[model samples]
Target: MTPSTAEHPQMSVEDFEDLARHAPETVTLEFINGKLEVKPVPDGDHVTIFMWLLRQCMQARPDLDLHPEQGLKVGTYRNGRARPDGALGPVGHFAGQGEWADPAGVLMVVEVTSHDSGTDRRDRVEKRDGYAEAGLPVYLLIDRDADAVVVHSAPRDGRYAEITAYAYGATVTLPAPLGITLETEGLKDYSL
Candidate 1:
């Protein structure tokens, strides 16, 4: 059975869109199990790593467009909304509609770690299942505190079986369609 909006009662897609349209500065929204929830605003460290990683991906592949913190509609269904820290897909507007991202068309989704205790678990577990359900081929996790990267792949049966972790100074190569590599050594210089 699929989860419903009741699972997270605080928000809904319509409510979120209203906020996005009327009050975008209020908070960042993410839909989890059919309900909308606010995501924590990224800190300075988060921005530093995000921009650096974006640059890395852009430099390696000049053809694709990589966006930082772009909202997405999952499963061709309006119930799911996700704002990947970094989202990469085809280089064009949405087909036919010129709206929400094409889930099946995307190559990868990335999330940077949060200092909140529950942040890692949510991104690693809840979001892992969420992304897999959407058939996103690759998910990358950037843990700034640890100065490492975690790459999850092979989404089978609504879960990923392969997870590779890279520590500081290591070069992490992204999976197919992305073909980007992240440099870890410089991440330590990022301020909170």
Candidate 2:
């Protein structure tokens, strides 16, 4: 059975982390406002699009490092932290910073939107704000059902001023840090 975004009783971040540590591997938890929300894994289309996008980035710049679904802490005072679908960073970006690189230094962040209502809202709204507030320059959203990719950039005063969308067959140009024109053909046959 798939995980649902049911309301979880309020718990501190530490509590959430502790629970997550012992949680079964089959489950994925995302903390929101001190509550742990179970996030269902992505469907076929979501993974397909994500892999294609990652491949594009890898092919364009072999030196770049692209990580899938890694936890990252952002926002001032770590008010909000999340594990995005994919995050791009320079080679050795975390050389002396340990395994996880600082979210503030991330080059790009991508979220593969799920069908769940709460997941969709969090990906489209909450994350957008969180990433912006952390000053992440580029944010990408791959909407499966919509069969579209949304790119957000140009953070001004802790908000994204430029938002664009591209459907299949369209070349989506990303902003700086993740500069690349993704061809639509590769992402066309995905379930989205």
- The clash numbers for all candidates, in the given order, read 0, 0
Give one digit per residue, the lDDT tens place, for model 1 in 71-98: 7776324357777898776676344633
Q: Name the lDDT value of residue 167 in candidate 1.
A: 81
C-alpha TM-scores of all predictions: 0.82, 0.85
Query: So what's the TM-score on candidate 2?
Result: 0.85
Off by over 4 Å in 2: 1-9, 94-101
Model 1 misses residue 138 by how many Å?
0.9
Q: Could you report the Cα RMSD, in angstroms, for every candidate shown? A: 3.4, 4.6
lDDT of every model, 2 decimals = 0.73, 0.74
| Residue range with the least summed lDDT across 10 consecutive positions in model 1 | 93-102
lDDT of 1 at 175: 76
- Show pairs that collide, candidate 1: none
Superposition error at 170 for model 1 (Å): 0.6
